[model samples]
Target: MFYRLMKMIVAPMLKIFFRPWVEGMENIPAEGPAIIASNHLSFSDSFFLPALMKRRVTFIAKSEYFTGTGVKGKLTAAFFKGVGQLPVDRSGVRGAGEAAISSGIEVIKRGELFGVYPEGTRSPDGKLYRGKVGGVARIALATGAPVIPVAMIDTEKLQPPGQVKPNFGVRPGIRIGAPLDFSRYHGMENDRFILRSVTDEVMYEIMRLSGQEYVDIYATAAKRQIQEAKKQAKQSGAEKQP
Candidate 1:
């Protein structure tokens, strides 16, 4: 009920304001369980992808989004919940990855579309990063669900991190790739090499669709490098300021 209400107002506004164009939407199955595996570029990637889809896509968000304190926290929780997002504890728990995969399997068994970011986190740079296999690959092999590669083109420009409002009148592009089936690797989810092979293939398709440069390193590592570089620059500047 709340999801529908928020969509009623938010969807139209996004279409008019952002003017995103979608291609290969026919690849999306009309019904049944499937996973929409996409590259994480910006915060709005979640919002824009589902707004244009005919079916509801649920993505696992951080539990912090749902556990805020105060009136502002309540509103934040309501908005994320209304958008069909489920929360998982991403606080470095040993079972965090397992919990995410379990949640995805349940959603797939229910014959609903489950969205996942194979990279595990947003790209610190625009380049497509290596995928983390524990969530998407494990769930697909476990449930026999097809994986669809989705590309959120240039969404980073629309609403880069720390920007409260999106830049209007910018047209973002969404491309959906053909569904990938990994039934060949069924029952091999526990095999580390098989999981890496499956995850690499999915990231390749996303890179093709998004036309972004592929990076072999994980996004998290790249973020750390960027932060360290910034810190050094700041310290250097402080030394020079006599």
Candidate 2:
């Protein structure tokens, strides 16, 4: 009841505010357990597409979102909650993957539509990065759900990293690809590799719709780690030089 009311209220408001141009919404199942896979671009990306969708789509949000308290924090929590998101803590170095997979599988088992970003995190460079097979395909294979590839363009431009509000003029939009069926590969008997390949195929479709540059390297939390190491080494060498 709350989910339905949320869909009713939020969808129209988003359309008016974002003026989003939607495509291929027909690809989404009017009824069934399905997964919508896409590349992550911005914080607003989650809210944007779900507003365009007719069905109630749920995504996994970081647990911090639910824990925070304040004006902005409560508003943020309310927005996510209204949009059918459940908190999944993907914060630590370990156990995060297991936790996510378990939560996702449970969501699917209830015959709900699930949303996942295959690229794992937002593109720092606006280029589609390699996907970590982690738990997306695992849940799909486990639940026998079809994966729908969606591409959101200009979303990053709407709310680039630090700003509190969207820039408000860029007309955000989405291009959805056809639903991918992995029925042929079903029941492969715990074949993780095959599941990854299936994940890649779904990502390939998203790349086509999004038209973003592709990077084969995995998205790592080590970006700052590597940069800081290089900086320290350079400073040390300079001090020794004279």
Which predicted model would earn the best TM-score?
A: 1
Candidate 1 stretches with Cα past 4 Å from truth are: 69-75
Candidate 1 clashes between residue pairs 3 or more apart in a chain or in different chains: none
- How many backbone clashes does every candidate have? 0, 0
Give RMSD (Å) of candidate 2 vs. truth: 3.0
Q: Candidate 2's residue-wise lDDT over 1-242, tens digit each?
A: 65566677877787788799989989988887888898888888878877678777888888888777989788778778887787877768467777777778787888878888887777776788888776668877877888899999899898985667788888989998898888777666278689779878887898899999887876564345556888999999999995
Can you write out model 1's per-residue Cα lDDT over 1-242, one digit (the tens) per residue?
Answer: 86897689877888888888999999999999999999998988877887778889988999998999998678668867887888999777657878888889999999999999999898887889999868888888888899999999999888886676788756898999999999988888898898899899999999999999998999999999999999999999999998
Off by over 4 Å in 2: 1-5, 225-242
Candidate 2 — worst ten consecutive residues by lDDT sum?
218-227
